[model samples]
Target: MRIGLYPGTFDPVTHGHIDIIRRACTLVDRLVIGVAINRDKGPMFSLEERLAMVEAECRYLSEATGTEIVAHPFENLLIDCARDVGAQMIVRGLRAVADFEYEFQMVGMNRTLDPEIETVFLMADAQHQAIASKLVKEIARLGGDISHFVTPTVARSLMDKLGRG
Candidate 1:
């Protein structure tokens, strides 16, 4: 089976992420959503919460697309995480030129680490290209509507996280 790893912090899974996940299903039989445990980012949600959100969001997508979607938590190098999941490809979502520049550098580093693993970039749909988790959180924290960016469940979670719910 062709397995792909898509790694991200996913502090709160946004619509942009769902768009990528839905599109990524076409490329691989199994898509592993790697929820990064990066303490450096100071995530608004806990690893468990993030995992639950990712898993919940992916369940419907998996059923709809007939693809196996699983959420895995990882604190190690992304390349190592891909190896652990036995993934032959790393799927990344690109929003803009800025995202491409960073992802390009990451692809190069990952290739050096494991020349056999390929990285695939999927451009975010136009509707979601501007939606980012960080911006979603900020908007929620400031008492702005985030319904357009995240699912209702995630929006509620963000509100609760910010003590606004």
Candidate 2:
């Protein structure tokens, strides 16, 4: 069975993220969603909060898509997380040219670290092309509606974190 890994900070798990996760699942037998604990970014949500939101959001995916989807929290090395999950390919989503440039560099470094693993890029669905976690958080913090960007649980979590709920 082919396994794939989708690694991201997923600070609050945006709809765009769920879009990528669903798209990635169609290509692999199992897809592991790695929530990176990159503390350097000073994430608005804690690791536990991020993981919980991802878990809550993804719980129905396996049954809905007939593709096993699991969310796990990881730290530091992404290649290590991929290896641990037995993933043969790292799945990435490309929203714009900027995303491509950044991901291209990361994919190259990941390939250099593990020659056997490959990377696959998918274009984000047009409807969600502009949704990003950072922007969602900013909107929520500034009293703007972000109900359209993330899941209900994530929306509430973001509001709670920003002291708006």
Candidate 3:
């Protein structure tokens, strides 16, 4: 059984993120969506909240794709998480040239950390290439509708965090 790790901050799982998850599901037997805790980049939602949001979003993904998808909160190194989960591949979504550049470096670093684990990059669907968690948060904070970008649960969570709900 091939296990793939999809690690991200997932401040709130967006439709774009779900798209990638759905796409990755086709290649791997199981996909573990890792909700990484980043201290450097202060998040609008807490780690637990982010994990909860991802969990809720993934339920819809699993139902839609009929794939085994699990979300786990990881405070440790990604390499350690991959190893712990026995993941053979790290799945990433590339949205643009900038994302490619950044992910290329990360792929190299992940390879250095664990040579057995390979990083796989998937291009984001053209419609979702411009959607990002940061942008969704900013727009939602400014009273703009983000219903199109994220799931209803995520939209509500973002609104609650921004004190708009």
Candidate 2 accuracy as TM-score: 0.95
Better of 1 and 2 by lDDT: 1
| Best prediction by TM-score | 1
Tens digits of per-residue lDDT, candidate 3, 42-146, equal: 988898888888777788778777778898888898889999998999999999999999988888888898899998899999999999999998999889989
Give the Cα error of residue 88 in candidate 1, in Å.
0.4
User: So what's the TM-score on candidate 3?
Assistant: 0.94
Positional deviation of 151 in candidate 1, in angstroms?
Answer: 0.5
lDDT of 2 by residue, 53-152 (tens): 8888887877788888888888859899999999999998889999999998998899899989999999999999998888898888889888889888
Write one digit per residue (lDDT tens) for candidate 1, span 1-165.
999999999989999999999999999999999999999999999999999999998999999999999999999999999999999999999999999999999999999999999999999999999998889888888888899999999988888888878
Model 2 residue 161 CA deviation (Å) reads 1.6
**Each prediction's whole-model lDDT (CA):** 0.95, 0.88, 0.88
Residue pairs clashing in model 1 are none
lDDT accuracy of residue 15 in candidate 1: 94
What is the model-wide C-alpha lDDT for candidate 3?
0.88
